[model samples]
Target: MKEYSVTPNKNAEGWYVKIEDVAPTDLYSKKDDAIAEAEKLASNDTPSRLMILDENHEIVEEKKY
Candidate 1:
């Protein structure tokens, strides 16, 4: 199972999903959306960006999103 963190930023412009040292991905939506997106993107990776889990942050559930 993978882990992910959801952070709300007042100056960040939108919500974000941080997966540790990795570059944070701006979800530009609510926290739930960010988590859902992260979970969906976790299994898929791309050169432009990567979808991963945050070992430090606790995602709502251990399984699924």
Candidate 2:
């Protein structure tokens, strides 16, 4: 299974949607935008998981597809 995650940037000024073990390709200014992109990626890749993290880098929500 693959995994995707939405996490705040180091500066907490942007969000990133990343695939497990891979570098993020883009930065989103809004958390919701990052989450939406991650969810779409996870759902398209069945048997994948999406994790949403807060500014503190703690997992706040998770979804399996």
Query: Which prediction has the highest lDDT against the true structure?
Result: 2
Number of the top candidate by TM-score? Answer: 2
Model 2 scores worst on lDDT over the 10 consecutive residues at: 17-26
Per-residue alpha-carbon lDDT of candidate 2 for residues 1-65, written as tens digits (9 for 90 to 100): 99999998999999999999489957999988888899899999999999899889899999999
* Steric clash pairs (candidate 1): 3-54
Off by over 4 Å in 1: 1-3, 10-13, 45-60
Return the lDDT, model 2, position 64. Answer: 100
What is the clash count for each candidate, in the order shown?
Answer: 1, 0
lDDT of each: 0.52, 0.91
Q: What is the TM-score of each predicted model, taking all chains together?
A: 0.43, 0.94
Model 1 agreement with the true structure over 1-65: per-residue lDDT tens digits: 34444555655445677664356667555556776776666545322232323334434344333
Worst 10 residues of 1 by lDDT: 46-55
